[model samples]
Target: MYRLVLLVLLALPLAGCFAPRAEDTARNWRPMGANGLALGRLVALSPGVTRATWEAFAGIKGQTVVRLAAEYDPVRAAAGCPPPEAGMVRAARSFLIVDLAVTPQKSVDFIAAKAQAYSADGYFEEYDLDIGVIAALAARARPMPCADLALPGYLR
Candidate 1:
């Protein structure tokens, strides 16, 4: 009886390891804020693909965005993609504006294509609607608030 109880206790812990993981269910669902964007929308918007496929694509795109956002400096400098006249803060905000205007499929395609091109050439030189999307997102970014010296230290 003691041996059986011991075996059950050990198996109980291992059972969790065998239990299905969320990744197995929602493959493309990235934790939010990974790239300051929600990639699962791509799966939700796409037609014909199974949920699993869409989830996988979303995961891939999320990782791609994170990587690209991190490597943006090198690509921007190398490709001579116009120096952001408004600054990267504005450019980053521009992504929100661009997201509002484009369909998920289009956004996914744009990112995927750009990532592919970047992977091959170490730059993003091809111009398309995506360029306009980036510009718009930058243009629409909210400016930082002016500092108020009169305000209390915490409020300021």
Candidate 2:
């Protein structure tokens, strides 16, 4: 009887260990480490891949869902850390593109806030890097607050 009682106590703790923890719904960004940049590099390396094949290769059924967000390298820089290397910047940029593709509104909102904080320079840099973002905004009839200035012909 004592053995069974101890066994039951041990199993009870095991059961508690397997219990699900609460999900953090408020946090939208997820870190994917090096794995996060793989898809972007693949796309960059290979062009004209058929949608079906790409979809099959990147099927979500067995894959983990990762939502990329802006990197906090600035905070690290403030702490005396060196600026991110080219690969890290590429990963961050790729992640931002994925975020823009998957969640346009959220991405735009984030970009807009950044633009507001940093002024037209932020928008100009973002626009220069990715025209797709501006196109996405236009397609959705969303206002581009950062386009407040009369950009030169070169920028247009």
Candidate 3:
């Protein structure tokens, strides 16, 4: 029984290696809860402050990290994501939706901690996401003007 449990534990990472790729469009991506992806491996598909932060945090000394980013689009959220948190709707339109994503290296605890930090900063709401979904969102995301909503050194 101990051996079986050990085997299962060892195979967990390999399981992630086989998960389906998230389609490259918000319209094609599954809804948040329905996205059949583990909470680990958050997505960041474009270069920006958030992406840089995530890379510094999770990219271990020799690990090949894939960094990405997506600008938040309220118009696509209704179709691609779950309903926004209470203040998110107004904030999304007014403030830059600076959601952050980490690749599949850090533990869930690490992400939870990062989320707490991001939330306490009072900038944008954080969401658990897979790299594929983020890629899809990135593909569909248009360059919306965020100069008025952006905070210095935050997502851009």
How well does candidate 3 score on lDDT at residue 99?
Answer: 28
lDDT of 1 by residue, 1-156 (tens): 999999988898677755433323322333233553333443333222122222122344232221121112222212323443332211111111111212223232234212111222222222223433333222332111111001122211
- Candidate 3 lDDT by residue in tens digits, 1-156: 999999998898788755432212221223244554322223333222132222222345432232223333333323333444433332342212222222344212121111111222466544343334333334443222222222334332
Sorting all predicted structures by lDDT, with the top scorer first, yields: 3, 1, 2
- The TM-scores of all predictions, comma-separated, are 0.21, 0.17, 0.26
List residue ranges in candidate 2 displaced over 4 A: 1-59, 71-153
Per-residue lDDT of model 2, residues 1-156, tens digit only: 999999998898677654322111112222233334333333222222112111111213332222323222222212333443333221111112222222211221122222111222332333322344334332332212223112333322
RMSD of each: 16.8, 15.8, 13.7
| lDDT of candidate model 3 versus the reference | 0.33
Q: In terms of lDDT, which candidate is stronger, 1 or 3?
A: 3
Say which candidate scores most in TM-score: 3
Clashing residue pairs in candidate 3 are 44-68, 44-69, 45-68, 45-69, 46-68, 46-69
Q: In candidate 3, which residue ranges exceed 4 Å CA deviation?
A: 1-58, 79-122, 131-156
> For model 1, what is the error of residue 58's alpha carbon versus the real structure, in angstroms, after optimal superposition?
20
